[model samples]
Target: MGGSGLLGLEVTRQARRAGQRVATTFHTRRPDGDAHHLDIRDRAAVIALVRAVEPAVVVNAAYLQADWATTADGGTHVALAAAATGARLVHVSSDAVFSGAAGRYDETAVPDPITPYGAAKAAAETAVKAITPAAVIARTSLIIGRGDSQHERQVHALAGGAPGALFTDDLRCPVDVGDLAAALLELASSPHAGVHHVAGAGAVSRHELGVLIARRDGLDESALPRALRAGSGLPGPADVRLDNTKTQALLTTRLRGAREFLASPLPVE
Candidate 1:
């Protein structure tokens, strides 16, 4: 694995608990438990890491969208690593890959991204598929769960009295971190290989989700401003909600709805 972000860390921890031999890399924040430092951008280093670990399956949560690039080149690093090692690769992706002009999207839809980040991710997906047809690409939406993910951070900020306007028009499917991790693990282990949508069951706007969080935590929803619709500032789809019918049928685990996904237990192991 590369880039030990929240998703990476969660998947790593799950794999470890399941008694799978797990080896991962870290760039900036070296995880306290056990992690090495390997920059995916360095192709030689990626190849070296793969050879050393000799993993049968590799789940790449390493992303560089917010920084180096978002889409095409961003995912190339991990794809190359998987090819070099002959490991089945599971590349986590995002709903942002679509323009958002069209609300819900499926694996078959042509990627038309409006943001640099989305375009980069789309590029990465393309590269991964070109090299390794069997490489799995899982696109999802606003993922929520432990360790200060965007969603958790927002909640924390709210709890700490941070004031901001939540956009009701901004829609997404926010899957819990744990549930997403489980789904990814299943994909890695199974024979299913292709682009999939691994996210929560239902769709919601940011403002609506904020209200749900507030209600769950007993926070004051009235304090929050009414939701508002906003544009991408670029030509693109609006909803871009993913259809997970394929994922639901293929994987043993069932992705939950947002509410149920949130109400579920946190990692205890």
Candidate 2:
């Protein structure tokens, strides 16, 4: 569904690497080399594109712009369109679907979204599932990589010192974007349906994770600010570590932790 976003772009890259013909969508500021502009909010446009492509597999990595429209409603539109064409559907989801009231979430956990973005993602899962029961919904967590990831950007933002603090109470099992992309491509051809937790094997607070990354990347950990989460005004839960055993058992790809990935000589994906 999405062709230019982080996941979409990587999926396209890996798929092409594996020698599959590719057709992808873009939003505003179309990417170079024949990327089609797709306003998923316009259901007719979405349907037209899917019908024209008639791809064997459609992976939905589009997210978070117009949460209600692009994510929530857009996912449903893609599902309906893909379903009608009898294409296998792989929908990328988020662990934020839970309230963070608890942790170690699996496929069985009922969604209790607390934040607006989380609520929108939860809505998308609901609509996609109701319309396409056979679709695979991969609920993952914070995406971390070598370049301008949320973690790397936060580190740079705090290099000169920013306001507030890097959250120490909020926890997530950050996933390598490449591992996630690989797993999605594998599942697209499989029969895994409902929800699957695809994330890092280890759980750590954001502050802890930042410190680890800084230390591993040769940046001073002291350069980053730190604070414990203590208010309800915050957007998300205190914990959202995913149980990746299902994912591990399901695929040969191993989703390593930040410490593991950062420690590597060559960071893949």
Candidate 3:
């Protein structure tokens, strides 16, 4: 999977801390830790790796950068391989499965993806389900945490006083990367199967998220640009906040919101 990405890297760390022997796969970028080279698009590569690893649980955190071959088709390949091995599979997915036209989407909600990324993810989920009914499809939201590119961009925007609408009208349930990683690991061992909304308990507008991040970082909130997604005539759906109650009930983990997570003291390095 995408062990180089934010979630994958963190999942690797968390899984290790929990005393589980871990093995991760990376794409082109050389990962910071030991990892196997894998292009999920290559079905043979995926199967061979799975068989060699023979992991009790397979976590597919790998994704592509706007490429369908890996993003859309990759999950299917992993699911198929994991199915053949009879290993529990946890596939990381996105809330993009829901078109912003509607919000508070639940596990049972039919996917109406408005973006190509969403479509690809939805397609991957379908294929995974068909291939492995016992797999756990974790559809999460904006993953915000330290070292995350999006979080860094927001911080840089506030520090540089970047002009224009620091505005984001689309609503999302931004989840802490650590909390999400924990939830994914929990689901790996749980009996739950099918799609689950693994997101923060709080739902806020993108603009609000920026403000919260700015405030948390002690940046000039007044300088944060404010724009409306609808006002800007953005061509995509808005408000794809998810209902995480199902996941919450299933696991003891708590996925705190941006405001809540930000309010906590930055860890002393």
- Per-residue lDDT for 200-241 in model 1, tens only? 898887777766776665668776665455553534344768
lDDT of 3 by residue, 136-211 (tens): 9999988987745575576557667665565566788988899999999999988999989899988887778777
Candidate 2: segments with Cα more than 4 A from true spot: 265-269
Count residue pairs with overlapping backbones in model 1. Answer: 20
TM-score of every prediction relative to native = 0.91, 0.94, 0.95
lDDT per model, in order? Answer: 0.77, 0.83, 0.83
lDDT of 3: 0.83
The backbone clash count of each candidate, in order, is 20, 0, 4
lDDT tens digits by residue: candidate 2, 1-269 = 67877778888888989999888889865654547899988899888898998899999988873468888889989999988898889999998789877777888889998888888899999988898899999999888866657777787678557765678888899888898899889888787887888898899888888887777667788978887787746667888888888777988788898777767544555
Alpha carbon deviation, residue 39, candidate 1 (Å):
1.5
Task: Please give the RMSD to the true structure for each candidate, in Å.
Answer: 2.4, 1.8, 1.5
Model 3: colliding residue pairs: 1-62, 2-62, 166-225, 167-227
Off by over 4 Å in 1: 69-71, 159-161, 231-238, 264-269
lDDT of 1 at 132: 84
Query: Candidate order by lDDT, highest to lowest?
Result: 3, 2, 1
Ranking by TM-score: 3, 2, 1
